[model samples]
Target: MRSCIWKSLTLTIGFSQNLWAQSIHLNEVSSLASGAGIASKPLLLMMGLVALSLLPFVGMMVTSFVKMAVVLSITRQAIGMQQAPPNTVITGLSILLTVYVMHPVGLDVYRKSERYMNYRSSEFFDKANVDMLLKAVQVSEEPIKHFLKTQASEKNLQMFYRIAQKIRKAEDRPSLSMNDYIILVPAFVITELTKAFQIGFMIFLPFMVIDMAVSNILMALGMQMLAPTMISLPFKLLLFVMVDGWHLISKGLVLGYPL
Candidate 1:
């Protein structure tokens, strides 16, 4: 009886010791995981902050802001009102117009990046969510790519393709596709610039005629000392107001993009 009791006690003690060892190991793992998680959070936050800072510039490249701003600036120049609306006003107006035009694209991106949209900004300190954030970014970029591709001219795209081919190794050069932003972005920008200039030229024509007509009248009036621009400015403003120039320009710009 005594020997049996001794063996049973020994077995119980051995089992308890094994359980204690396992508990200690689990605690160590938990502490290490928490430590690593804590350490990584600040790094993620810094990267996020950097990305936020760069987002506006990225926005300018990918959105209608480039074309809108250029056209608006040229319009202001055409009106001979260099600073009448002010630079801040022009930039703000351009941004508002860009947002208006790009709202559908934004919605599409948000829908496609549902994971990102669902991500709680309140969880800013969470390190594990970084991978999800990156995945969201990748998915979100697709819609912007679509927008750029739709607006980008094929000839301009080919031009950038040739340039990119020259820039990279023969083996590294990828085929020109909307999927590649490196080739697509410059092409989209140049295309926007070309279209903006074309619009600007049309805007200039009416104003140019006004200036010339005013110049001839002044010359016949023996008023060479007075600038034609000064005399024509009031008449130009009157003509623009009569035809609702702002409304027409805004309508044309909004309508220019394929629905």
Candidate 2:
């Protein structure tokens, strides 16, 4: 009788487990059937959030953000600040300036998008988008062309014009297209980089003089062990402040670009 009771108890536990497993399987099957017919709202929302997260990065790459940020960052570094003004501050300033520079182009894009969404007008959307982008490219192109004319040789111009001509021929157009805009972006970027370096060299000269003078004075005064950087930093800051260096730099940068 004892053995039979133990056997019955074991059988009961096993049966319960099997029933539970079957119920779980049924639940999974039901879920699959329901999921097959419709997308979950949560999933759509998650995807939208992911796309939104990437929007800033896309804007940085495709707009004036990259050039502005790079130039400002380089200028900060050249000043020998070594994160003195802070990366966040530099980036924030760059963003504000980029917004100012790109405002008109952005307005054009926004107007076009609004018209398309409100009127279901594909033609207007296409026309507006293309025209806005072209205008932006044209604006950006002027600065780049100016830089190239000053820095690059005639041979470089020939090569660039050849590429532009090829692009025009491929599109069977006498004017630039969106694809041409792609080529112009990198060309413009290179031009900006070159100009930034040139400007950085000029900016570094005064600081370098201060550094050398401080180092020589420290050594001559039998204080060779003193760090020149610590001694020179204050003077550099004072000079920068007195001369309104920030204003001069910002004005030069803003004016350097062709309208």
Candidate 3:
């Protein structure tokens, strides 16, 4: 998970390189031949720090984290569990499952950018070379981009692409291509959310039936004063345990992502 998060940060840096370029003065580099050595390094470090600050948001959106987290939360609710697993446990399990699924993509990013990552301090930092950083980020981002493209639904992609075109001015519309990360990320998120809800609906069925049965039994017994939830909770828990729900849920969520 850490690896994937860091790799995603590199992609964020790549996306913001133009902004970084704008912040630096080109005349300073022209005036002082060693300006890159003195000035560029600190600016790059600051930008990297900013990228780190956005890590959590980027990490959650691009990975299987959202789908896993949402599905787990839905599972807890369906089981009539208000707090037994706790929010923390659900979040931790989702993150771990995301890590398991994304580990390969992280490794791919590392392998692709290994040469830039392992540069001698003198080569990478001693000189002011923003191109090297840009190239590294670009190389690192491809695997993640491919992952998003694969998981994102074509219907959502087309929807977002059309929306992006509609929002942009005619000339700018041509610049906003279908493959852009700006378009892909939102589409990917919507796709994941749609899948999570579909899975949640399936999970809710049996438990819903249990609740209905308990409620009807109470009605037949003329026990309207008693809460049906109190009666149904144990049966829901029993059914969950009997089917080994946790194992099945974990397996399905982990396998849902393309590793």
Candidate 4:
């Protein structure tokens, strides 16, 4: 009687387990069907948040941010005061300057995307079309691509285009046209870096002259053990301030862009 009762209990438990598994499997299938029929709101919002988080990185890569940040950092180094303005201060200034230079481009992108933004706000997930997202991206990328193309030199474009042809498969190579973002972004980056270095070199010149002059005076006075930077730093700062360095730099950067 005990064995028979135990056997009956085991069968009941097995049946319950099978039923539970079937329900779970059916629920999963239904969820997939529902997901296919309508886009998920929470998922879209999460993706949008992620995209927003990456905006700074994207700005640094494609905009004048790289050039502004690099030049400003190099200028600080040239001044020989490692912690005076501070890295945070330098970065903040660079970001602000970049925004100033790219304001027109930003306005254009916003204008192009206003309709989509309004639609998303009004309907949220109800009107969310995957095509709308694609359209928004496609529309936004055009102004940025145009800005990059304007900044990137012909030689830089040719170099990347040639490299793309070599590495990509023949069938894919045809699609990788001269105007493709893959070719354009790297070229634009290199161009920005080149311009930054060119500006940095100019920034270095006056400070470097001051250093050499200080070093010579120290040598002549037989104080060779003293560092030139210790004397030249104050002079560099004075000169920079007298000339209103920030205003001049901001002006040049704004004017340099073809916008």
Candidate 5:
């Protein structure tokens, strides 16, 4: 009876000790996890703040903002209204139009990144890891890259690719893909600027005609003292308003994007 009691006591003590050890191990793990979570929040927050600061610049570089802004500015110049709409108004309008055109691309990126973004942590900061962030970027960039490609001309892409190859060492050239942003971004910018200039040129023609006609009339009247632009300004404004220039320009710009 004594031996059986001792054996049962020993087994019970061993079981209890094992349970205690496991509990300790679990508590340590939980504490460490919680600590890591706490640490990452501030880092993530800092990075997010930085990103927000740079967001406007990034949007301008990657989206249709370049084309929109350039076209709008040129239109303003064409109207000879340097300060009528104000720089702020032009920039704001471009931003609005850019957002309108790029909304679909943004949605596509969100959908593609949904899997990586959805996590049990309840906050993005808690769930964000290097691997997860990289994966999210990788998935999200596909839509953006596709949009860029659609806007970018093949000739520009090839030209940039050739330039990049020439700039890099032979060994490095193989690592540089045509789809790389270094190649795509400048190419995309060039393409957008080229198209914007073309639109600007067409816009300039009508205004140029007005200026020339006004100058001829002023010369014929022996009133060369009056600047043609000053005389033509009212006529230009009348013409623009009559044809609903703003409406047409906005419509064309917004619709021009492939979505």
Candidate 6:
């Protein structure tokens, strides 16, 4: 009876050991699965971040922000305000102005989107969104067309129109695509550059005269070591401020485009 009891006890111990080993294997499998899930989460998060980063570019292209920002930057640089007023300040101001100018366009887009969404119509959504985009483009196109018409030749316009026609052939209403308007953007940009340079030249004229006069006077008085820039800069700033230069410049820029 003692020998039979010993054999039974040994068999029970063996079974218990097998069960423990099985539990350990299952635990390892669970740990591996959890680790894999954690690893995949980071990849998904990284992809989402990448997509979000592209949102600004998309917004800029879809809005009037691009031209507004570029023109503001050009104006700032032309005035020799290098790093003065800070890039952050300039960018913030430009963004604010852009939003102001684009308020109506944005409202139109929102209204169209909301109408489509309420009706639960995907087809209408596409058409409405495209129409909204075209409206915004129309606003931009007016200024561009005016600039191009002033600067470009008749032949250039004809060439641009031909190219537009070819490119927009797939559209149902090619004229509504504003294909010619799209072609005018680069030409308008060139015209803006020319006009800005002309303005910059005029701005430098008074400063240049002051510099030459101050240098000549100083040299004649044997104060050759004195710098003219120090004197001229203050006068330039004073002249600029006295005439409400910022107001005039801003007004001129706004009026330069057709509403």
> Pairs clashing in candidate 1?
none
How should the candidates be ordered by TM-score, best one leading? Answer: 3, 1, 5, 4, 2, 6
Candidate 4 lDDT by residue in tens digits, 1-259: 5332222222222222222442444233223333332345455455345545555556577678899989988888998989878889988988888878888887776676555544432332233433443345546656767888889999999999999799867776666667666677789999999999999999899989999999999999999899889988899999999999888887898789866
lDDT of 1 by residue, 119-169 (tens): 443343343344444445556666667778889999988887787678767
Question: TM per model?
Answer: 0.80, 0.58, 0.85, 0.79, 0.79, 0.51
Give me the runs in candidate 3 sitting further than 4 Å from their true place: 1-8, 15-46, 122-130
Tally clashing residue pairs in candidate 5. Answer: 0
TM for candidate 1 is 0.80
Q: What is the C-alpha lDDT profile of model 2 across 1-259, one tens digit per residue?
A: 5322222222222222222442444233223333222234344344234544555654564455666677677666655678877889888887887667655554543443333223222332133332332333333334323333543334444555577667554544455432333343445556656666777778888988999999999999999999998899889888888999888877776656543
> What is candidate 3's lDDT per residue for 150-249, written digit by digit as tens?
9999999999899878976787666676667777889999999999999999999999999999999999999989999889999999999999999999
Over 137-221, each residue of candidate 6 has an lDDT whose tens digit, in order, gives 3333343234346544455555655665675546533443222434444444445455656666665676577678878988899
Candidate 2 clashes: the total is: 0
lDDT of 1: 0.68
* Number of the top TM-score candidate: 3
Clashing pairs in 2: none
Clashing pairs in 3: none
Model 5 regions lying over 4 Å from their true place: 1-50, 120-129
Ranking by lDDT: 3, 5, 4, 1, 2, 6
Alpha-carbon lDDT, every model = 0.68, 0.53, 0.77, 0.69, 0.72, 0.48
Which candidate has the highest lDDT of all?
3
lDDT of 6 at 58: 39
Clash totals in order: 0, 0, 0, 0, 0, 0
Which 10-residue span in candidate 3 carries the lowest summed lDDT?
26-35
